[model samples]
Target: MARIFTVDEARSLMPAVLRHADDFVAVRADLAELTHDLRHEGESPLGGLAEAKGLEARMDETLSWFDDQGIEIKGVAPLLVDFPALMEGVAVRLCWLEGETALGWYHRADLGFPGRRPLP
Candidate 1:
């Protein structure tokens, strides 16, 4: 019974979504870089447990950010969406203006940006 939203409706929520997205990506990137450092150089690029804790903290921050915007990340595989009442279906996920498609595509949570597909 989750709400489904139209591309426009989703787009309208972007400003807030983007805020969370920015932090999410930054934390993700930092984590990735830290992993790379551990793998290639055998070094802890981010220092110690505080860094790990910080990543988790950032993730919590992003979730809070989404909550503030009234959006929730539901599935893991090509994320299943529960948008507003714009489109009224579970097939569509949020679409951003900068996306290659016109907010008119399907994307899984796992696939992220690469999962975009034309609406049928």
Candidate 2:
């Protein structure tokens, strides 16, 4: 079950979420690069493999942080997260993505990112 967050609670959590999201994004980027290099360069050196593993571990840890906070990770590359919330007594998702300055979007519980509407 998901915990319901007030708008203020969600906003208060955003700073820490953003910090971990940034780290998660960076580690994912590094993994992508390492994958490309391994594919194009015909197998990675041991050190390259080690670095990739380390990045993967970091990614897992960062994601676990979000899990610990009860935030649902919707995407990795763009760092989308959804906080469970209630808008007008109906369940909804409080949405935030990388680069957004604040929690300014939301959607019905059954809808997704495409259904996002700006929070009033």
Q: Which prediction has the highest lDDT against the true structure?
A: 2
**Whole-model lDDT per candidate:** 0.57, 0.87
72-116, model 1: which lDDT tens digit per residue? Answer: 666422323334433344454564432222345556545555766
Prediction 1 global C-alpha lDDT: 0.57
The worst-scoring run of ten residues by lDDT in candidate 2 lies at 42-51
- Pairing residues by index, what is the TM-score of model 1? 0.56
lDDT of 2 by residue, 3-99 (tens): 8899999999988887887788777877897888887995664347778888889999999998888899898878899999999998899999898
- Per model, how many backbone clashes are there? 8, 0
Best by TM-score: 2
Candidate 2 colliding pairs: none
Model 1 clash tally, residue pairs: 8
Residue ranges of candidate 2 with Cα displaced over 4 Å:
43-46
